[model samples]
Target: MTGTRLVIDGVTLTAGAYRLVEDVSLAARPGEVIGLVGPNGSGKSSLLRAVYRVLRPVTGRVSVDGTDAWSLPVRQLARTVAAVVQESGAEFDLSVREVVAMGRTPHKRLLDGDTPEDAALITSALAAVDATDLAHRPFDQLSGGERQRVLIARALAQQPSLLVLDEPTNHLDIRHQLEVLGALRRLPATVMVALHDLNLAAYYCDRLYVLRDGKVTAAGPPADVLTPQLLDEVYGVMGEVTIHPRTGAPQVTFLPAEPHPAAPTGAEHSSS
Candidate 1:
């Protein structure tokens, strides 16, 4: 929790005639895990893009530790914040070890040499994600989940203050999903993860940001923002919100929507 505090003030993003995200503001303190949740196309990804500098915001600012993130040099930003995005394709068939070593690029000079210390750090990162066994394996040959873990280890090798993950659980099994997220929670770095699974988010996140249609529908602790009414209104579904008796965090169970009447047959429609 040293220097990871981030503040987003009135951030807005646009694409041509469309406003993808508008007036999104939030603050994340050091060592906290914040989950960004919303339906598909709700601008969650767009907001992430803005934060990561892949897409510049149309207005407002993103600040980290009282300094404008945009003002930081690209290499400085890479050293401070590491990200694991949804789509990462490796065109070259590098070994897993080689891939993980690339995380050190931000710290290296144009012709700087990597010492034995750098190699040891890469090995440590591989061990952190349980990818040491696959270090020698070809990256292209590993399973989807294995690749995901290696990528995560690569990000960890950066030793960043802020770690951002967009859909890290995309290809993971339930057990691996929990394992990855649990490990992330145990890390000291401040984290912001975009998650689709409400149950997982409820289990791991210290705070939540619920986005709907390019704006924040609710922002607070899970118990305060994830009410049944809010879920129904934002997600178009009815669900029960209950507290985990042990943890006291909000847990949601979705209920089926009521059925609608069937459409009239073609013959009946013609007669009408």
Candidate 2:
């Protein structure tokens, strides 16, 4: 297989005194697309950070290809894993091509420059994200969505066996969102992405793990995990889930929450 196997077993993450994820266990086979879906403050990002080596778990282990991730050297880990996180820093002063080319750093000596092979990968990555036109432009001048696409291209250039992305569709138009995700779906890498869009996740992911309040609420295939009852319980909203006839993916239609009963009029509270 071309991709890496990821095993996150009995992992618990905490921030000082606060627990962000509690006893979470998940695994992704080579070349599978795994979705992490949950509401805000539901520990999805925290879990991702742990996988990408930003946060060390308080308990349990994260292993890639049977090796403990924490025990690997940073450069070795970077070669195997690439992450596109939400909190990307300030605008770079470099050109878009330069930023994307940075992905080659892990494989090169400090004095080494871009070889023809590196150039090809850079061009291919840009094309993969539909960002080839923006390559010559300065990265600082691009809009949010453009920068996001460029970041994704950078990750693609790394050619990691496992790719982790947090809301890669954010700031993208509908067309580009589909393009980016479709490109990811075709890659020979194991992908773990956290998404707020249920329909998109259902369409792209081979399996899903639902998080809520630092715990896993559910885990399974879309058809098995995304029932109306699960949606209501986990998201606290009424929703209808159906299979799309053509796509065969679950589609969710959310309805407004029921209103609470009104209090009695002022006259009913008056004392005689």
Candidate 3:
């Protein structure tokens, strides 16, 4: 869980004439949770893909522990980093335990069979996400929240130093959303998550990186970045900012606009 120092220097992703993400530079240190927040179409996923080596950046470099990520062998990278994307589909209808056991694939040699230790690790991972009881159940039949937990357990079984999650809270209920987020926060890895919920991001992320139009508009502690003005300008919504009484973190309240006064008719205008 330590030694995960991720750096993206001047990274840019382009598709034809359009740039998806532009000059995005940031770092995630060990034991820190950095949240990437933005509206849809804001290139958060594009930036994450570049960092996780899913999509190579057309410009700049991504380094993990001072090594060029692209140069690292695929197996080696998989051993060190684990990702939980939005999709958790298993066409073969594997059980929860089998799904979690797949995380050990990167660590296994060719033709290697699972050891007792591997089984223990998988069991622990499932328990960590509170999916132990469902270990024998079919993964495909589980609810969305249960499925997301299983996917996270799969990531945990990898024993990664860094965990990258994209919208991990999607399709989850409020309680499960908080539970998943809480489990992520408790992990020792350096976590970088692409989040749609600003409140969750503010509560859990050590720092917030606000992306807008393929660029970082603001980056800092949540209290400094999640201001009413910034949220309005970037998200195009009016909101009130408040501090959570318990955590003292930034808590936001969206406010709909009041109607504007109508303009006078032509006769009133002429008289004026």
lDDT of 1 at 174: 88
> Considering every candidate listed, which one attains the maximal TM-score?
2
Estimated TM-score for each candidate: 0.90, 0.94, 0.92
> How close to the true structure is residue 134 of candidate 2, measured as C-alpha lDDT?
100
Off by over 4 Å in 3: 258-272
What is each predicted model's overall lDDT from 0 to 1?
A: 0.88, 0.95, 0.89
Q: After superposition, how far is residue 121 of candidate 2 from its true place, in Å?
A: 0.6
* C-alpha root-mean-square deviation, each candidate: 6.0, 5.9, 6.6
Q: Which is better, 1 or 3, measured by TM-score?
A: 3
Each model's backbone clash number: 0, 0, 0
Write model 1 residue lDDT over 1-272, tens digit each, in one string.
23399888999999998999999999889989999999999988888887778878889999888899999999999988998999876654799998999999998999877789889989988987778999999999988899998899898888888888999998888887888898789888889999999989988999999999999989988888889888888998999999989877778989877776789889887854
Question: In model 2, which regions exceed 4 Å deviation?
Answer: 258-272
Q: Which candidate wins on lDDT?
A: 2
lDDT of 1: 0.88
| Model 3 Cα lDDT, one tens digit per residue, 149-197 | 8899999999899899999888788987888889889988989999989
Give the Å error, residue 178, model 1. Answer: 1.2
- The candidate, 2 or 3, that scores higher on TM-score is 2
In angstroms, the error of model 1 at 129 is 2.3
Model 3's TM-score against the true structure: 0.92
